[model samples]
Target: MRIGLLTEGGYPYAAGEPGLWCERLVRGLGQHQFDLYAVGGSGIPRPLPPNARVARTADLGGSDSGPTARNLLERTAFGDRRAARRAYGRRERRRFVEALHRLAVGVCGEHTAGTGEAETGAELGIAFAEGLYALAELARERGGLPGALRSDDAVRTLESACRAPGARRGAAAAGLPDHLAFVEHLERTLRPLSLDWYAEDALGAADLCHAAAGGTTALPGLLAKRFFGTPLLVTEYGVQLRSHYLSAAGADRSAPLRTLLAALHGRLAAEVYGQAALLTPGNAHTRRWQEKCGADRARIRTVHPGMAADRFAEVGEDEESGDPATLVWVGRVEPAKDLIALLHAFAEIRALQPDARLRIVAVPVRDPGSGAYLAHIKGLAAQLFPDEAAGAHAVGENPVTFEELGGPEAPTLEDTYASGAVVVLSSVVEGFPTSLVEAMFCARATVSTDVGAVVEIIGGTGLVVPPRNPRALADACLALLREPERRHRLGAAARARALELFTVEQNLAAFRGIYLELLSHAPVRHRPGDGVPFAHPAEAHVPGSWAPKAAAGTGAPDA
Candidate 1:
């Protein structure tokens, strides 16, 4: 089957977790044809799988020089730029204003007091849908949405909605700066409407549209389902709305601005969840988030992230556990990882087991703040273990060592996981905990803080403690360190569970079924002169069932 795969900042253009998983998915599902619609990223895309090709790519930076509608029109025999511009004149302007007004109002309004939340929510949803589709249609016709959305008129309409009676208090209090900020964000969010992929030869021609993530990436799939009869399958490893909230929480923006933006995202998420044919969240954690944001439980499925376990096979299968007294932590060095707490926890562990060592192995820093955070961690380590600080220069006598993944000490992930007896995760905020899964793949026992999907991923195979609690984290680590037999049993179980559920083969099998299941229920779409296999089956022309008729002499009833 032909699949329209929608993605953003991942897939062909970027090299990261997002791109890796997508590449694996494409390579594994070689039976299906994939047409990728990638958004944003500059460097060369990785080589495409045999069955996959990039259908279109858009820059999220909004650098499109020609609108899709105008370009398509100009290519026609009688089409001209002047005529296209005239098409977006007075009448089109009125339509755009009306649609934008309705959308802004829907986004700005709050639930009524007397009316049940369900009723008011449904009404707002309807309003939002009407405005969103009307705008999409206008973009298809005039291709002026990108320009008009950035115009003064759009800001005025949004302001009027915010100031209207019964608007949410935060929205009513929005200042000029907030209005400008929101308009810019809104333009970027709705930019997908202005793309040329909505035509019959693009998203409309696909057997199914698969959105690789939620939020802006899903906009095209939403439009495809609206404009054509294409079914949309939305898969979200990370909840986009949750990410928006986290980023906004850290921003220096006003409460009113944050409130307005939150409402916009919440409304959009609700729409996407409501319309999706099926919602596949990477884990139960994301499934709950989707449900809270209005996804139907019946339509939701949990699919774990897939990992390549072959690289760690030797480590996992090895019966000998490395240094029984060593505890290792591996991941990126970020504030969220709470390495400070880990350091404190290790201090307690050190007091109990002086000979015990800790390896603080980190991947290369990605965020600008990470380098500073890593430096702070190193400083704290020095302060806690002053004697060890000096011993580091003398020899490898330091109880705590900080090293990068590919450095001299730890040349690879397998070496990092194999070098320690127990794996530790002290993250205060985690999603899926890829490092913990990596430890499991290496057949290493883990002691992780209870955050995000830690408990779920561990599945009773390892110990989990409360986040930010040094005592608890330390105690859990000690329990595993003291019991060699228990650690061996848990590590063996972890490797078995990882192989059963988290391998790439398992992930590919799940999606292969999901794709066929979605297609099976979708209405068959056949166009004229198409080279479809059974487009005009002989039995389809008959009104009744294709049962054999009784013999003419028998006068029997038709079977």
Candidate 2:
């Protein structure tokens, strides 16, 4: 099978969870050929597997007239520099405006007041999808939308939509600057519409389109399905709409601008969910988000993110290893981790058990603020528990020790998990809780805050406490620490569960089956002069069981 793997910002080009997961999926499914379509990736992509190759990439960074725009035209315009000079005629400009106007109206939250939510949602969904596909068709015919989206007409359309009656209160307050900002953002978000990858030679040839995420990353997949009838399989570990909300909360944008952008993403997410053949969420928590966003319950499946268990196998089997008095917290140090609360909880733990130690091992994170957050966490630790050890030989070092994963003290992930009896996760916010899963793989007892998929992933194998509750967190950790047999039992059960559900093998198996299932139901797509193995069998044309027998006996050719 030929798979079109669509990704954005990461995958192949950047090193992150999305990239790592895509790389692993491509590598694991070596039997199938993969064509990677990436957007806005930086740095040299890691080595491609033998069965995979980068088919196309679009850089969404920089402004409309910047180098990136020129590069996009050069690459997607089939090497025709004259394509950049191609402008929409009067009629073409009108078509573009109409399509864009519908899109703006769809996203600007204009609906009949007092209407039921279901009716309003259905109306908005239809409008959004109609406008979205119309714009796609326009872009496909015009070669690209970068120029058109940056035109004055596009800004006018958006401004009119925002100021229209019944539009969102926030959107109605948008000014000229807000319109310009939204136009710029929309251009980048819809950049995939202009990519030439939808031709018969590119995504059109794929047996299945696997989107690495939702939102803008899935735009290519959506187009492929729309243009070529290729089935789209959308997998999201971190919900893109959720990320958009979190990012908008932190951005310095104006209220009207943020509202407009949020509406755009929300409508896009709903469209993507509605159109996808299957939506694979990494956990139940993500599955719920998909369902809430209009994804069909029957089409939704929960596929847990896979992890390599071999790295921690030895530590898991040998339960006797690690300090019984030590607690380990492993993951990127950030505000979301709520390390301050963990420090306070640890203080309580220290008062009860003076020998109980906390080994806070920081892993690498992409955020620039991580360094500052780690420094802040260190400062708090110092203030909370002043080191009584003035000399090197003082009874034992402070109960809390901060170390990086690759440092001499920690050395490796396996060693870090093996160095503690109870693994702790204090994240007030989380996604799939990769670190907790790793701890489970190491067969270590865990006490995780109730966030993200913690409760679902733990499944009663480990102790769970409400997030940001220092007393509750401390109590759970202490309970596990005091009962050696209970900790060992829970650790063993966790290891069993992780091996069964969270291993790389299980993840690959689930996708392998899902790929075949989706392809089996999809119609065979063939292009002119393309030799597609069984494009149209005799049964497809003749119908019924007798057709196969008749063809066999008469030596008749397939239709």
Candidate with top lDDT is 2
Worst 10 residues of 2 by lDDT: 76-85
Q: Quote each prediction's TM-score.
A: 0.90, 0.90
lDDT (tens digit, per residue) of candidate 1 on 1-559: 7889997685699887878888999999877779999966566778997889988888877522223433333332133324434557878878988999889888998888875978988888788888998999999987637467656567678999999997899999997767766776788889889998888888987888998888889989999999997899999889889888877233777788888889888988999999999999999989999999889999999989899999999999995958999999999998889999999999999989988899999899667888888889999999989887876543348899999999999999999999999999999887778998999999999999989988889998999999999999999999999999999999999999999889999999999889888887888777643443442242223333322332334453332
Error of 2 at 440 (Å): 0.4
549: Cα error in model 2, Å: 23
lDDT of prediction 2: 0.85
> Ten-residue segment with the worst summed lDDT in candidate 1?
72-81
Model 2, span 21-111: residue lDDT tens: 8888999987788999887776687899888998888787754233343444333334222332356676887888899888988899655
